[model samples]
Target: MARLSHTSLWMFMVFLFSSYCTAKTVTYDFNVTWVTANPDGLKERKVIGVNNQWPLPVIEVNRGDQLVVNMHNGLGDKNASIHFHGMYQNGTNEMDGPVMVTQCPVPPGATFTYNFTVNQNGTYWYHCHADYCYPDGYRQALIVHDNKSYFADQYEEEFTVTVSDWYHELIEGIAPDFLSVYNPTGAEPIPQSFLFNDTLNSNLKVKPNTTYLIRLINIGAFVAQYFYIEGHNFTIVEVDGVYTEPTEAEILYIAIAQRYAILLTTKNTTDTNYPIVTIADSVLLDKIPSDLKLNQTNWLEYNAEAPHPQADITVEVASDLNPHDDMTLIPHDHMPLLPDPDYTITLTVNMENLDNGASYALLNNISYTPAKVPTIFSVLSSGSLATNSLVYGEFTHPLVLNHNDVVEVILNNNDGGSHPFHLHGHTFQLLDRAPSYGPTFYDYKDGSPVSYDAFNHTAFPQYPMRRDTFVLPPQGYFVIRFVADNPGVWMFHCHIDWHLSQGLGLLFIESPQQMQERLTIPQNHLDVCRVGGIPTEGNAAANSVDYLDLKGQNAQVGWLPAGFTSGGIVALVFSVVSAVMGVAFLVVYGLSDLKFKGKGGGVVEGSQGEGAGKEVGSTTVREAYRDNGDEVR
Candidate 1:
């Protein structure tokens, strides 16, 4: 019996230890402020920073842990909000943090607390969702580690490498001109330089003959980049926070908001430094002007060695690699093949020239505009579909969905330029793609030089690649599928800053009824709208009409009383004054009676018993006073 008791005690202790290790809480207190620093070699400009540090701060957590961030905004007059890119946010939709979509922007001198659970483990990032804020240096890497990672034993150490396209002028200085009506060419503002981890020439030092896991994140606002290192090859193990089958590549093509985990092994040769090159794809560039550099070079050194000769290295672009190829990416774990979709939506994407000559992007002939009140707030408060129409404009497209429905979306890119599309709150499975553009320039619209009858819906693999961001090539179409399980108002849009500002997006209203029951928005989120200078409106540049008409209809009233005259108006004023005085005198008399009664006066107390006697006396006095006044008049 004693031996059995000891065994039971050991089991109980083991259970407690396991539970304690599996669940933990991670918290961070961050202050968002402004600083002037030159990330590129160009001139210094004002940029937003977290904890007064540039490039923000990296957040690392373990799976099944709770992450709580207390963020205070101090960017003078700018409003800001942080979005955890690629996070499933699960039951915490308010913390998803897209300005004017999920909640209001955190105004200057305000604080917001983002608390959510880290259910999935992989690479992710966080950035400001406010217009042009992320491009102005409000971003950081977010890594969630898992004890059962697919390649846990493959590498000894890990490092995060961020690449971006930098500009000389701030977004505010460039947006107005680039989106002006007079700018008919629709030329996007070109970037002036490229950066590696917010530095002009960043170096990744390593030991010889060792394998390192590099987390590559493309946090750029506009261009997609091709990254590679001289004399080294890497194997990609993860993409957009999902583990994938290992695929070897010489160069990686990463789009904005996309992330990849690659294994890099140093050579056994003598210690030397190699060049890490990142070049902006000129295919996405629209009419590049002279004097702009596209290629950026950093260093990968071994044991603090000197840089090797440039002639010994050769740079290559990975444009030839097809992202939709079957062997490129497969699910690390087995995923069941999806059946026929419960909902299928076909969206048409194109550019339209407004009457005012300003360019705007459209989805199904309608441009999305943010409502005065947040959609989440409106839905929760009212639980009405009509609320969506009232808050969002009439033109805002809402893909209403029910819970657990398999949804398939066909994105037809009817534009002349490539767009990097990103979906919030969930990662979707890429089904298939069909390209229409080639050596011959194909028109974007139907009945043109191209025919889309050959859509490749049957060509998808058993387990498709899942990601949050993918390139929608010009004059091409792609299909993606996802289950409508996460309930919220999610924004699906192009990642290009200029294009998003021009309204190339739509809202996916998933399980509105369920969202109302599950979402609990704090008073702090509602308070953001009451604060001054915080933007509550959606992208206004996308509107076809720039101004609103506030005039009301006029009414006419022609007839009046026949005897009305100026002298009659004077007599009417005198009667009104007499009536007002009579009421005031009665009120004073009643208050005095109440005061006398309180002091035990017999006159007021006796009147309560003889009400008729008191009325007779007051009536006689009123009659006498009226007769005297009439005689004086």
Candidate 2:
């Protein structure tokens, strides 16, 4: 090989770039910074923006296109990263972003790149996965175009509709108060307003006699939404990036991180436009504000001149709406349920306060805590010992799985609320769920909770529906199964950002031996850890020499006393400490003699001794007040 001249090299590089672009290499240079946005028209607040654009940019790519995002952390005060939700990053698991799980949070002025191939196609999304990062307008719809879609030729056009709950304040400002001891029962912070397509009173202009593929995604932080169109019913085609057999549905209950694509044929006449309705799931809220608009209205505009009236909600509340039962759906591919699970992970979802008086969500008895080193680095650095869960630390809730094993997850909801759980790498089959959709679906909380018994349950579906995210009903149980074919560190956690912050999640270290063979941590990723003062090697405790030692790993806050609530414990401890210190300070002050301003020969040298005292209000070293109207206390 020989070096080319400057002019020749430049021309050659241009040719290569042109060829790459032609082959569908989609690239985005995102400058992650803060900007102001007012989606609800109520208040303008600071939000995370890409390329200085709020309501962030929607990323579109053809199936199999190599997507490359060169991200720079321009948010000077915050750390950030992006997670391509519903994407199965097969051989490229490092690109799956969840701070402390796959990679370190990109520090201020640092750079990180997300380069991976989009293999599957359907409704998906991308959002900042760093703790408290995405709620502030850092998320957007991600569509993968498939020329060979089953309904590709049946529909004339397609549109993406995102439903979300909006807040007037930044997440950082809300976390301290939301997670404080005063907020027991782990009540989630209620959003200020619900949005349609990131705005209010939006319209999806459509023509009569046209069938459009509408993509619905609930990119919300806390509350789930019920979606429907007045006087219209759509045929459901896909859910969470998995295509399902066409099933008619009049209403849908979409939880956070869930996506649904439906084929909706417009009415033959354009005489009237229909109202698209979205209602917040009030069951998830502890207290709904009187002015917070729960029912949001958009439009399926048949004629721009026609009046678009408000939707007539048939139900009194969101719970009264009967949405389709996802477990009863059949996969378009007809993929049957997986064989009996080779490994079964049975855990309960619990909400309780730790010794610190702050509430935390736990799986089994342990709440999730981020390790000192990223979990991905620990897998790549560990040798044969990667198969051993001991190296991953205790608080991380590490579950080392075998390669290509059939894994079954049985989630028992011990808490009194609903949780939408999502898995990072694979979509599992919805095997069985107790208390199916009907009048009693949302009424599960009124009675004792039902737990799934392996020996007893209804028959599993023949061709079970596959989805990346699913909702666990209130105090009800759900059983799901998936094959562990992908080799990487995938997280199994609740999609609620607030609950996740309280530690309601765990890591699935699948096929560690295979991960060690196929994956290599990128140099740029390593540099990010170094810049952030994070260790890239060692166990979760950052003990490199001895992988089994987890002595210093991060752990959840200690437990409160047996018979006291979080508030009671905090107040007791605070009062006791204050009284003891108050008495000690009183004794010391009482022993000292007072210096009167009239009898001042000079100031006493020390408060403990009676000596010559200086004059009061003097500007000398012994004076109690400064000459600039400042007291020395």
Candidate 3:
């Protein structure tokens, strides 16, 4: 009878826990405003709340619940919005809520409601959609806890470690002139100071004997920055917004745009104050020779604070999980995952037109050229070559990686500037780097020697790191790998505001199905183009023989039907012109040198000997184009 009673009680408790896990309907309100209190004041002063408090209040909810968040803008000057990162929910596109992406900004005295569901269960965050120039105080943390039964015995306390960077400029409204700002030829350095949860100087206190889960997020700009608990080692169990096979480290370097959830149990140490966390600022081109000097215009000094070799915080050890003990915590099983393909495309950073009046840096061979018109019109218009033609140097267009392909990218920075290149929708592994760089295989290029340069390797014990966004240091490159398992038209671009506006971006389409589902080419978006099918006659009706061919044919360059007169064709024409001009000039110069040099005659002088010589060379170019059936411009 007692056994039966115990079974009944167990079933009843399970039912109650399941009910709690499945509860629905959660609503939250976030208000935005400006305050004028002096934080540096020595005396007590009243500090006004932008919403209703500082550091904002915590948001708590459970999985599988409807979430409706209303944002009120009281910040008299600018628009406002909120974005919940890494959450899956209905109305994802609508709820993406970036100020200009899906909805308009909330002007002063206005309010906006973001409605969605929390279908994902894990640690995630919510922050203002303002430009990167905004202050750190504007962002906050959010927790969607698992029902107690889910981790009834595993979880004890949750500690949110929201890392941030600080900038004195107005980050949000600094755009519209982004082109001017990120003009590769510009003179300004990107911002440098960083913080933890809006505090330039604050720390998290903990007792020695407890196991604490630390949710680490880099809502900042630098990539490959290492965070270390100097006297302690911990295990990393989750990356990005998902769980991972546990990895351990004392020093951890994270690529920009990534999140890691680490579990650390502190152990007691002697009464001496030991360093808990130390951050080492990364320097681009770390392997460069000390005496080497690139042109002043081609290299910039690393401006972040000197690496924090000294731990920033120290506290007394209180429990069995002491600062002195080494620990290992691995998840029981690996998460189920899909397979991917293997192909890598490298984005090399280099400079051109050296010493020329208008020299600029190039990714591949494509220069950063911002659209003269607004992005909205660029999205809608057909005549703008800048918007329609997706160019990646001399390489192929619309880089199509098949679904399930193991894709890797090497962002090689040859110029002096550092760029935080961000990929949308997915996170990637740092893999291994060139032997002369750092440690760990989390980041790597195609085939660097497995073993070399052990001296510098030991310095960064936390590498190769896992990250979503990583910076390409000046004249250096970062290799990142990931499975191209997600299907979509994902945007891969530099996170630097100006660089992105200036065309340092490209789209990576995963599959044909994904391509068709996501793409709305210039021709497809216009009514006239859709009606005519193509500019050519005789292929435009249901009964026409030509129409049947069009219908039956697989979509390819040949199936394009050749008569569209929008941006695509115009871009092709420009490309052709550029190519022909280049070849003509080269041939003319080559032949002239061959004739004048006479085995050893000076080729340079011969090509410029007389006006007639120059004119003859020009005439050859014109004749060459005429023979190719093209008119010389």
Q: Write the per-residue lDDT of candidate 2 for residues 1-633, one digit (tens) a residue.
A: 999999999999998886567557899999999999888899999999988988888999987789999999999999999999999999998999999999999999999999998888999999999989888888999999887888889899999999998889899977876776545556677889999988999999999999999999999898999899998899999999888889999989899999999999999998999999999989888887789989988999999999989988767878887889888889999997789899999989988888766789999988999999999999988788899999998988999899999999999987788889999999999998766664567677877788999888999988989999988888899999999999999999999999999999999999998898998778999999999999998999999899988898898988876898756755664464456445545644554555433355766434535332322212332232121112232
Q: Give every collision pair in model 2.
A: 355-558, 355-559, 602-612, 602-613, 602-614, 603-612, 603-613, 603-614, 604-613
Give model 2's TM-score versus the native structure. 0.87
Q: What are the clash counts of all predictions, listed in order?
A: 0, 9, 22
Candidate 3 achieves a global lDDT of 0.47
Ten-residue stretch with the least lDDT total in model 1? 549-558
Which scores better on lDDT, 2 or 3?
2
- lDDT, residue 626, model 3: 30
> Each prediction's Cα RMSD?
22.5, 9.7, 16.4
Among the numbered candidates, top TM-score falls to 2
**TM-score for each prediction?**
0.78, 0.87, 0.55
Encode model 3's per-residue lDDT on 454-500: one tens digit a residue. 24333221223344455564445666666766654345666544454
Q: For candidate 1, lDDT tens digit of each residue in 376-432?
A: 665565445422433344444667778999998888877767787899988888777
Give the range where candidate 3 is weakest over 10 consecutive residues by summed lDDT.
Answer: 294-303
Sorting all predicted structures by TM-score, with the top scorer first, yields: 2, 1, 3
**Better structure of 1 and 3 per lDDT:** 1
